[model samples]
Target: MALQNNEKFDIKIVYDKFEAALHEEDDIHLQFYLESFEELNKFFTLMGTVFGFVSKDLKAKMDILNEFLKDSNKSENFITVKKMIEYEKQNELLNKKGYTSGSRTLLRLHRGLDFIQLFLKKLGDLRDEESTSSACREAYDQTLAKHHPFVIRNGAKVAIYTLPTREILLKKVCGELDNIQKAMNLLPETLEVTAVVHTRIEKLYTVHDLHRLP
Candidate 1:
């Protein structure tokens, strides 16, 4: 769909709704870009990741463009992400030879992946925080561990359901992580999970460390 700013949509309400969606673990808004600010947030992360993956150096420069776009910062020359992706792809095609795929298709793919990233982040964060116990089952559960039955007398004796944290991550977050890790040189398990989560969630993107990324 064509994009335009609809003044009727309140940015403040959308912002608050975005946070509340996280807190409440809702997915309706995540399904569609109903809120403009949130839409931008998702788009930015996707753009950042795609740009980041293609070249470490280029990612850093494009990030300046994103930082400038921040509403908190006063800046001139707003740029559309689509246009930026288009331009970057064109340059890549012109400067290089033996192209593997069309630049236009790649650009669209990156932008589309960013959209997927935004939704997954909101979706996964909801459960990781909300479903898992407080502080990810580290709080009262730890204290109450003594009280909880370590082993069942007769039943399954399930203290905590044993689940491969990575499996949950794959199902809920980015399936791409699983594929990339298996295909590419082995990355630290945590990095793989984090990469998956980063694509799906925003807080990870904001974090400082690349390894600690997400």
Candidate 2:
């Protein structure tokens, strides 16, 4: 999609949808968001374009889950994150290798989301142009890097070096200089809300897993 006003990144829309999807703890409400995965994928692709190497694995994981959800026989049992986890467990769908279950796939994406949230938070908090790469690097190292292979981590560091300058990031996210401070201030709160949602979903998964254990 073409950038609006030649400056359209607008991560806020993605953040809004993510928040809404998280709030949908009810199966029916979660289904509504799942049905809109196409729109979400578009945003994901846009983010991948901006960040380059950071998003391909996430996109792949999303595709896997989306395909699984499209299966009529299996989709019904996966209306919510909790339900999806249960379905995977009950069906013995998760594997130790190759073709990991949708629940695990989504867990990977959740981890990536945490990294993205941190990166955006850092980007928003920046006060100078020179610090952009360092901010992204710091966020990546603190979050995603812990789980990533050494090669992947090194590649991500290289990608961070190529990130757009602070002015560009601010303009893309906030539209104009006047809006920057307001947008920046919102990032921390947004991260907090998303973290809560992620933790809740994770707890649900853990509880379900425990119930299934011998």
Candidate 3:
């Protein structure tokens, strides 16, 4: 990567914040730390965003993965890395819509964005326009327990996810095992996953890679 101009920039500030998030000494302290890192008072500003709208930390994480795959450069490696970025972006978009991570709850429920909002507004404004809303349309159903991550969460990440990459493909057959393990952490100590998961084995499978996870 190419370095920017000699104008001015401090790398330590971000480094400190990243380190702090990993080892949250105190809840209050962590709040202050994250804010401190973001506030202009604590760090410099730039014309462009430090991170993109989706998954601000992706580029940095990509760098790490790149180093790990430096010698390999296999297509699978790139596919895995690309899918990870896409997942992060999708999650970032979800966050923008006010969905909190790590939790399996919806605050705003089903909110139609500006496009739909504008259309409805225009319909109401028209002299002879009629509009109907199927807000009751359920985006989820019984499959939610397995497919929709909201019904079940795994530490701020989707218990299951879909992507067209080798990594996600692997995650599918493994039942997103890592996240499954984490989700298990949320279960009652006495409850067993095998008892319920097996009954819900009809997970949709169109493609092999992200089929089960999706």
Candidate 4:
């Protein structure tokens, strides 16, 4: 697939979708969360093949949740994070592996979201001419690296070195901005909104004790 130009993506759209995903304070609307994640994937896409594996991994996780939403019999249970957990657990559907239940699938995506939130915070904190690869490495180490196997980590270590410096990456993902400084300025609000959605999902998994799902 051809990579979409950065002009086609607005970083703020990710923040907006995540903000909308928050429902009734602690609850998250599943559809909005999926949509926000889909938007966030564009950032990886815009970065080019260096992060293709990250984007592919995230898409696979989202596809699982979308399948749950498409099932007529179980669609109601998949409408919100809270509902999905209750329905899946009450039915004893989470005992199996390989994302056989909504809870398990969403847990994978939630971990990916944590990596993204951490990555953005690191990106926002970078000084001039710093390597974006370091931010990617640090974020991956803290989040997804824990859940991933040795082979995946080895692959990511190679990909990380191919990333552009902070200035170039900011321009690639934030092409709509007048300059790199404006893009840097946009990161705080972006991270703030994303953190709220991440925290809600994190709490949901914590409450259900689903973090260790295979």
Candidate 5:
């Protein structure tokens, strides 16, 4: 995954995209949510090939959401997370066994977002000598790992070891700055905004009882 607009990786960009994703207090705009993930894909790409699975999964999920925006029948329903849930539930599309309903697809991305949020928070708290791999692994264990089976858990254990050192990881994500400290300072706001987006989506899922969609 190449950086969009040939741009450098910056935590501030991720922060802004996430903050832009929220609207009307509780509504989340799908386009901005995916755009934020596009910026996040760069973070995974910068880490190395070991994290390619993470990036590829996000790219695929983003493509699915983009398709919803393009489809004439579904586009209107997908403008906001709330609308997508209401529309999909009303139409009996949320649990059709194999159907790729917008609600179910976004739920996958929502889970991924949880992993990203936790990973970044851990990364931000690490000292210069701390292991980036440990942060990645811990974040995965707390979030995505619960949904993944044995094969993926084992694969992730190997893949996380390929992450660069804490200092280097900071350099890659905050590369736009001469001093990585500036970027580190942005993490709190970024995490807060992302938490709000995640919570909003989570509430929509709980309200509609769609958390168990498979």
Candidate 6:
């Protein structure tokens, strides 16, 4: 069945919107675009359904951080990542075990996003089913494995083994086997855009980490 207009996934638009919002230097101190987190959750659900457990964990973190932003006072709003980091610094809330603060929670989500980006980019480059599966495993090892517990890592590996063949992925994303080349072309572009966004966010997190140090 053909995907409905609303159901169609456009990675470029999603990544671009996030890039614009995140790179708004003048707005770093202003309120974050709250709806962006909602959009991001949708993206995760769309891309990570095969790895349901991972998606669930990511959704939980995103929800917690978004709720924190929604509930913040005017002066202490956790809108931008920078503002979130600033609030955490002023309140001394970083690194508190068993406590959920916006900065730390967002950092977790950011790590998850990095994994998703890596997996998608790798999947985008596949030439066959075996390659697709290999890419997923490699991406998982390179990114998420370090963060996930042993059980979750093993579970993810099991899920990777169940991934649909490259032909199926092409048809799912590009809408037809005849359009496989189009899908292949699209993935690299998507990966490039996603990498740019990921790099920017990682840099922001790095800066936040440096500031947290003495």
The positional error of residue 37 in candidate 5, measured at the CA in angstroms, is 1.5
The number of clashing residue pairs in model 3 is 2
Model 4 spans > 4 angstroms off = 1-7, 96-99, 176-182
Candidate 6, residues 1-214: lDDT per residue as tens digits?
1224445344545445555555464333212333434444454354445667776777687678666756746345566677767777777777666667776676676677677778777666666654467787887899779878999889889878877777665555545554556545566765665566566667777776732331
Per-residue CA lDDT of candidate 4, range 80-141, in tens? 99999999888788985444777887888888889988998988888759989988999999
Q: For model 3, how does the per-residue alpha-carbon lDDT over 1-214 read when each residue is reduced to its tens digit?
A: 2224432223333334433433222111222223223421111122122112112232333334334335354323222322322443455532445532211111111011112122223323333222122111121122222332452323212211211232332233223456434423432321222112211211211121322221
Which segments of model 2 are wrong by more than 4 Å? 1-7, 23-50, 96-100, 128-130, 172-182, 185-189, 208-214
Candidates, ranked, TM-score: 5, 4, 6, 2, 1, 3
Alpha-carbon local distance difference test for all models? 0.31, 0.62, 0.26, 0.83, 0.83, 0.61
Candidate 6 segments exceeding 4 Å error: 1-6, 25-49, 72-76, 95-99, 128-131, 173-186, 210-214
| Model 5: worst 10 consecutive residues (lDDT sum) | 1-10
Instruction: Please tell me which predicted candidate would have the highest lDDT against the true structure.
Output: 5
Best candidate (score: TM-score) = 5
* Residues 1-214, model 1: lDDT tens digits: 1224321212233334434323222111221222323333332233223222223322343344445446353222223323323344445542355632222232233333343333334333443324321222342233323233544211211212322243343333223554434422322332233233324333322231212211
In the range 58-130, model 5's lDDT, one tens digit per residue, is 8888898999999997698898999988988888887787788888888888899999999988888888787
**24: Cα error in model 3, Å:** 47
RMSD of each: 19.7, 4.6, 23.0, 2.1, 2.0, 4.6
Off by over 4 Å in 5: 4-7, 176-179
Better of 5 and 6 by lDDT: 5
Residue 29's lDDT within candidate 6 is 22
- Candidate 4, run of 10 with poorest lDDT: 1-10
Look at candidate 2 and tell me the lDDT of residue 202.
Answer: 58
lDDT of 4: 0.83
